[model samples]
Structure formats: structure tokens, C-alpha cells
Target: MTGTLITVAPTGAESSKAAVPALPVTIDELVATAKECEALGAAIVHVHIRDDAAEPTLDQGRLRETVAALRQSTDLIVQLSSGGAVTDPEADRLAVLDARPEMASCTMGTVNFGDGVFLNRWEFIVDLHTRMQDKGIVPEYEIFDLGQLTTLQRLLAQHGLPYGGHVHVDLVMGVPGGMPGTAAALVACHQAIRDLPAGSTFSATGIGRSTIPVILASLATGGHLRVGMEDTVTYAKGRPVESNMQLVARAVGFAQLAQRPPLTTAEARELLGMVAR
Candidate 1:
């Protein structure tokens, strides 16, 4: 099996300091956590900025602060959330691509937020993807459900690179009203992503308790993974995880047991076709 790239999403919009107190939120905390995750075998750190009281926001100033702190300590690839809080509509969501940290996640299509619908029209999607391409930043495609898969296909077709050098894809599963967590669900997501062009790579991430289930299934099926308190607070069934690095270490151990070695930061960069700085 090809080595896996373990990306640790230290803090996300939905997960809380209360749910997982060790979750990284502030600039200092996030940088520290990203460094620790890197130490624990994660090649990439997926970040979502939160406010002083732990509320998620993609506010430009806060994102700048968080990323600056991250660079001071490590060169680990930082992927930001353009899908912040799902409730924050289209106008409120965007990647501050000005910093251009090698990679960022771009949601293919919007789905329902808890009480309302999340919105990302073709204009926003195309504009962001175009911006990432122009900036040479790899945009990790996020698909919350099957319909979003088609949306990604449409974008891929529109881009049509000379050698299919499209941005990477991340199959995000287990959101409410989105795809359920099942082995079959994992298979379906794999098939959808594999249907894309030859060069693009994909990763699997599941919300809440389904995180490890999907990770392992993805591993068994030859796919990369993302994990941490941001996705699931538990270390195992009924057990609480203490930190993001703990989850990363557990994933590394599981991958070893499955005979799937993890991709180093350099190897991960190669897999995603990123240029070295």
C-alpha cells in the first residue's frame, strides 16, 4: 500500500473546548497543537480559526494571526476551512488565500446547516478554485454528500488541466442529513472520487463517532485520512481523547497494524502535487 498522509484538523467549527478541552483554538494553542500533531506523525494540520470565547469564525484578521503563529514553529502544510460553522452563509465564508499555505479546503457544494441551508453558488466556487489555482495553492475538495460529488466533477471538467493536475479531494462523511457512516458509504465515496481523473488524490474524514470507523475502512480500502478532536472527541468507544496528537498517534499505530505506512510531510507534498518552497 502507498504511504498514507495523516492530516490532523486540530479545531473545527462544531467541536468545542467544552467537548474536548484540549482542542486548539487561540493562535498560541493552535500553533502549539499543530506542532505536536506534526511530532506525532501528522504531515498536514487542517485549521479552523475560532474567537476568544471559542466560537468559530473565518474572520480575516484572526485567520492571519493563527497562520502566522503556525509558521513560526513549523512548515507543516496548513489547510483552512472555507466551510466555517456551516451557518455562516456564502458571503461569510472564504479562504484568505493571501498567505497561500500550499493547500486549503474548498467545499464543492453547500448543504443544510443545522437550522438553515448553507450556500455556495457557482460564482463563489469557481472564483475560489480559480484563485487557488492562480496562487498555486492546492484546494482540497470537500464533498459532504453524494450530490456534492457531481459538483466536484463539474468543477474538474471545467478546469481540465493538461495532465489532470486538479486539486485534491476530501470525502467528508457523517454530517447530519448528509451521508451516513457505513462501510458501504465509504465504498460509495471511494468510487465517486475514483471516478475523477487519474492524478488527483483523495482523503476520508467522518464527523463525530464515525471518524475512526471511516478512517479504518478507508485504510483497508487504500485511501488517506484526517482525524482529531475536530472530527471526533472520543479516543475509542466511550473513551475521551486528551489531545489532537493522541488521535494522530492512534491513527499512525492503526495504519502500521494494517501494513499501511504513513506519508511523511515530503511524501504528502508529492502525493498532492505541491511545489516545494
Candidate 2:
């Protein structure tokens, strides 16, 4: 098996300009940065797009353009996010993957986003899994907490869903209401994944300060690590990150020190079992 499969989430749906200066806002910028990350050592580029009106709309046409641009520009594995700034309507979330990127985000459970709710109703999740399968796009199951992994297993058992042999999971941590990304918490989440239905591949990512501890723990366990301005903005203490690629470069060194070699884009895709674009 290859080492850590670093998925560079250049821009999260809710990642703001205030948090990271070089956050990709335009399609051209996002595609350019994704290619840069691939060159720096990223296998998968997870994307979130905006509508024609500049709002975070799930316009399929815009998404197609983003995917096409990235494909034309780089050999990196492209992964679109089903997560939206507003995830109430599942159709809206699935619209981006209607263009059929190699992989799409499969957020597994509901979460409390500040004062509001980020609900992933049962019906939509099941239906979206089928949609992703119909388009031949593999899913990277996203878990905000341990319980959501259960949702993923249930959907897999019920529908033989997602239609892909390996389901890639992004174990998210330190999202306030979600699992705290401490070393022990990170280990606990990885343990929970071991009990998931057979044939599932998993990786861990931490938000804010928890990124350091969670990433270190993941490395110790032979699990892959995900880092970007989307997960964190600072490197250590109060220092700021120059770019998403900078964070990725730092992770590459960390992987080596942890006795694991960093994966190239091709190796990362193979390790994650994603379809190469």
C-alpha cells in the first residue's frame, strides 16, 4: 500500500477569505491551485463550486466547467463535494456530481453548524448514493463524528450502494460539536472505522489546532492524512500559512518523519481506490 493519500480540499463550502488569504475563489484560481497542489504532492483535489450568481449554488454547468478545466490542466484525481453551504435540498447537493467527476463527497450524517443544522436526511443520502453510482463516480464518505460511520455502513448494506467496491472515508474531527481532534479522539475514530462494514478505506482530517495532533496520530496508525487551508490555516502556534500547497508540503515532511513516505498523486489515487481522471 502507498503512504498517506493527501486530498487537498482547496476550498471548502464554508471556508472563508478571512481564514485563508490564498483560498481559491474563482474557477481559474481553483484549477490553478489544484494543479499546484498536485505538483507539490496531492493525489486528490476536492472541490466546491459556485452558481452563476456568485452564490454557492450547485449549478451543474459551472461544476462541469470546473471539472473539465481541472482535467485539462492536470493529472490529479478530481473529487467534487456533495456538501453545500445549505444542504437542505439533496438535489441541490447532487447537482455538481451530475457532471460525473471521478469521485464525490458523501457526507454521512447530520451535524450542527453553529446556530443552524446541516441535515443529511436518510432518504437523500440513500438516493444520492444511487445517483453517484449511476454516474460511475466513487464516493468519499465523510464522517463528522463516529455515529455517521454507522449511517454509511447501513446505506452500503441496504443498497449495495455507491456501486463502487471501495468506499473512501474522510474522518473529520474538531468541528466543535463533532469529534474533538485530539490524539486519543483520533485513535478512537480510527478504531470505530475498523468495525465498519468490510471493504471500506478510511482517512482522517482535523480542523483548526486539532489538525496537528489528529494528523500525527493518523500517521502513527498508518492512516492517510488530509491537510489544507480548508482544514487549518496556521502551521503551528500562531504562524500563518502562505498557501494550501504550503500546508501540503509540511504534511509530506511529516509523513516521512513518521516513517511513511508521502504519496504522489497517482499513488494517492491508488491508495484511496479512486478512479483516476
Candidate 3:
């Protein structure tokens, strides 16, 4: 198997500093986290920025500054979250692509996120995909349920290939209302879309308790991994994670033991079809 691509999601739109104190909220904290995670073997940093008050916002200025700061501070591939928060406006979410990060997320379909719905309508998905293509931003398709795979198939069939023609996906499992985070679920997701996009690849992030299981399963299945506070806040049962670097170091250890060493920033860029920086 090729080297495993490790992506560290330092912060997410859902959590707060009050809930997860280690969560990086400011641009400086995010840059520090990205640099530490990169040194610990993470090739990519999945980012979500907040306002001065640490509340989620899709403000173009903040997004641009966060992306630029990350780019200047670390060699890791910076992937901005277009799925800002459940409450963010569609126009604002779509406008995030204007920051022009190396990559951005494009959720395949709407799914119940906890008690709220993450509304990604067909037209919205197509529009986001088209815009990402137009801006030369690579998309990491976020799959929260099995049926979304079919939606992804429809997307490719209808919209032609995404930007670079290299399809990459992230199986965001274990959301309360989405697919379960289990080996079976991960395997089923892979099986469903494995044959659709030619040379397509995927990574898995199991939220909460599903983290370790999904990590092991993704490695065993020849897929990559997405880890850190975005999907998990605990280092173990009841153990709050101290830093994103801790999760990344643990993943690198696991990948090494499995004989799939972690990919460097350069290798990950090549693997994901991103131009060298």
C-alpha cells in the first residue's frame, strides 16, 4: 500500500472553546496547531475559523486571513471548511471558496446533523462543485451517509469530473443522524463508491467513540485517515485530548505499525493531485 495520508482537523464549526478547550480558535492558535501537527506527521490540516469572540463565521476576510496564515506557517495542505456551521447562510458558505485555499469540502447531500439539518440541496451541491472547479480549488467530497455515494455518482455523471479529475472523498461517519461509525459502515461506504470514480480515493473520520475503530478500519482497507478534535475531543474514553498533535502522533504510530508510513506534505499533494507549493 502507498503511504497513508494523514489529515488533522484541528477545529470544527460545531465545537466551542468552552466545550473543548484545546480547540484552536484564533488564527495564531490555528497556525501553531497546524505547524505542530505537521511536524508530527500530518500532511493536511482541515480548518474551520472563528470570529474574535470564537463563534463560527464564514466571513471572507477571516477565512482569507486564516488560509494565508496557515500557508505561511506550515507546509501542510490547508483545506477550508465550506460546511462552516449548521447556521451559516448558503451564500456565505459558498463564498468561502473565494479564499482560494488549496482545498475545500463539498458535502454530497443534506443529513441530520445532531438535531439540525445540514441542507445541501442538489442545486447547491452542483453550484459549489462548479465554483470550486472555476476557482481551481480541489474538493474533498464529504460523505455522511451511504446514499450520498449515489449522490456523488450522480454528481460526476451529471457535472463531469471535478477540477483536477482526481476524486477524493472523506467518509464523515458517526454523526448522530448519519451513518454509524463501524468497520461495517466504513467498508460498506467504500464498497458503494469504490468503482464509481476512476482512480478515486477516500479517507475516513469516525466521530466520538468511532475514532479509533474507523482509523483501524481505514488503514486495514487501504484508505487514508482524518483525525483530531473536529471528529473527536477525547484521547480515550473520558480522556480529553490535550492537543491536535497528540491525535496526529498516535495516527502516525498506527500507520507506521501497519507498514503504511505517513505521507509528507509533498507526497500528500501528489497523491491528492494538488500542485506543488
Candidate 4:
């Protein structure tokens, strides 16, 4: 198996400091988390910035500052989240790419997100894809369902190539309204993506109880991983995680046991075809 590229999603739009105390909401906390995760063998930090109130935001200044801090403090690849919060306006979502980070996320399609809807229309997806291409930002396509994989195929067919030309995707499973997080489901998703751009890679993230199963499946399937408080707050049943580094450490241990150690920052960059910063 290839060296696993572990991406640490330290904070997500859904969780808050009150719910997950160790969540890195502030820039300082985020930078500290990034450094520690990198030291624990995380090659990338998938960032979601929060405001003073600890609410998610796509504020250009905050994002720009957060990106700068991560760049200065660690060698980890900093990827900004364009899926800021479900309620975020489309304009603000598009503006996130303006922060000019090395990487950003582009959801393949809309899905029922719990009680609410996570909206992503074809026009919005195309616009984000084009803008990322213009800004030289590599996109990590976020897929919540099997059908979204087909949407991605259509995207590449119509848009030619995404920014950076290399394709990387994230299989976000076990959401309340999306695909079930199971070994069979993950393998099916992986098979579907095989028709994508040649050499396209993927990372699997199983939220809540599905976390461990997804990690094992990805490891066994020659795919990468996305782990942290963003997708899971618990280290085990009834056990809340203490830090993102803890989650990353466990992933590194698993990868190594499988003979696929975590990828270094430089190796991750090369694997993803990212431009040097």
C-alpha cells in the first residue's frame, strides 16, 4: 500500500467550543492544533475558521489571517473549507477561495444534512470549480452520496479539469441523511470513483460511530484518511476526544500497523499535485 495521507480536520462548521471544548475555534488554537497534528504525522490541516463568538464564518480577513498563521507555524498543507456553514450565503462561500489558500473543498452536490439542507447547485459547483481554477487552489471534492460521484464525473467532463489538474476527493459518510457509513458502502464509493480522472485519490471520513469502521476500510482499500473532532468528537463510545492530535496519533498508528505509514508534508504535496508554497 502507498503511504497514507492523513488530513486533520480539527474544527468543522457544525461543532462549537461548548459542545467540543477542545475544538480549535480561534486562530491561536487552530495554529497550535495544526502544529501538534503535524508533529503527530498529519500531512494536511483542513481548516474551518470561527468568529469571536465561536460561530463559523467566511469573513475574508479572518480566513486570510488564519491561513497566514498556519503557513508561518507549520509545514502542513492548509485547506480552507468553502462549505463554511449550511446557512452561509453563496457569495461568502465563493469568497472563501479569495483567501488564496493552497487547497479548498468543493462539495459535489446538495444533500439532506440532518434537519436542514446542505445546498450546492450545479451553477454554484461550477462557479466554485472555475474560481478555484483561476486562483490556483486545488479542490478536494466532498462526496456525501454515491450519486454525487456521477456528478463529479459530469463536472470533469464539462469543466475540462479542476484547478491543479489533479483530482482528490473526500468520502463524507454516515451523516444523518447521506449514505450509511459501512465497509460495503465505502468500498462501493471507492469503486465508483475509479472512473474519475486517472490517478484520482480519495480520503474517507465516517462521522460519529462510523469513524473506526471507515478508517479500517480506507486503510485496507489503499485509500487515505480524514480524521479529527470535525467528523467525530468521541475517541470511543462514551469517550470524548481530548485533542485533534489524539485522533491523528491513532490514525498514524493504524497506518503503520498496515505497513502504510503517514505521508510527509512534501510527499502529500507531491501525491496531490499541489504547488509548492
Candidate number with the higher lDDT (2 or 3): 3
TM-score per candidate: 0.92, 0.92, 0.98, 0.98
lDDT tens digits by residue: candidate 1, 1-277: 4688899988887777877777788888888888888887798888888888989887888877777778778878877777777677665565467655667778887677556676778889988888777877788888778878788888878865312175577777887767876678889877877778775667888787888788888898888889888788887778887888888888898888888778888878777777654
| lDDT for position 8 in model 3 | 95
- On a 0 to 100 scale, what is the lDDT of residue 193 in model 1? 71
- Best-performing candidate as measured by lDDT: 4
Candidate 3 C-alpha error for residue 110, in Å: 0.6
**Which residue ranges in model 3 land beyond 4 Å of their true spot?**
none
**TM-score (C-alpha, index-matched) for candidate 2:** 0.92
Q: Candidate 4 on 239-275: residue-level lDDT in tens?
A: 8999998999999998999999999999999888887
- Locate the minimum summed-lDDT window of 10 residues in model 4: 268-277
Task: Show model 2 residue runs off by greater than 4 Å.
Answer: 51-55, 274-277
Task: Quote the positional error of residue 45 for candidate 3 in Å.
Answer: 0.8
Cα lDDT tens digits for candidate 3, 163-275: 87899999998999999999999999989867677788899998999999999999999999999898889898778999999999989999998999999999988887888
**Candidate 2 per-residue C-alpha lDDT over 109-198 given as tens digits, one digit per residue, 9 for 90 to 100:** 888865668888888888788887787888888898878978887888888856457777888888867888877877777777887666
Angstrom error at residue 30, model 3: 0.3
Weakest 10 consecutive residues, lDDT, candidate 1? 159-168
Q: For model 3, what is the C-alpha lDDT against the true structure? A: 0.91
Please give the distance, in angstroms, between residue 49's alpha carbon in candidate 4 and its true position after superposition: 0.9
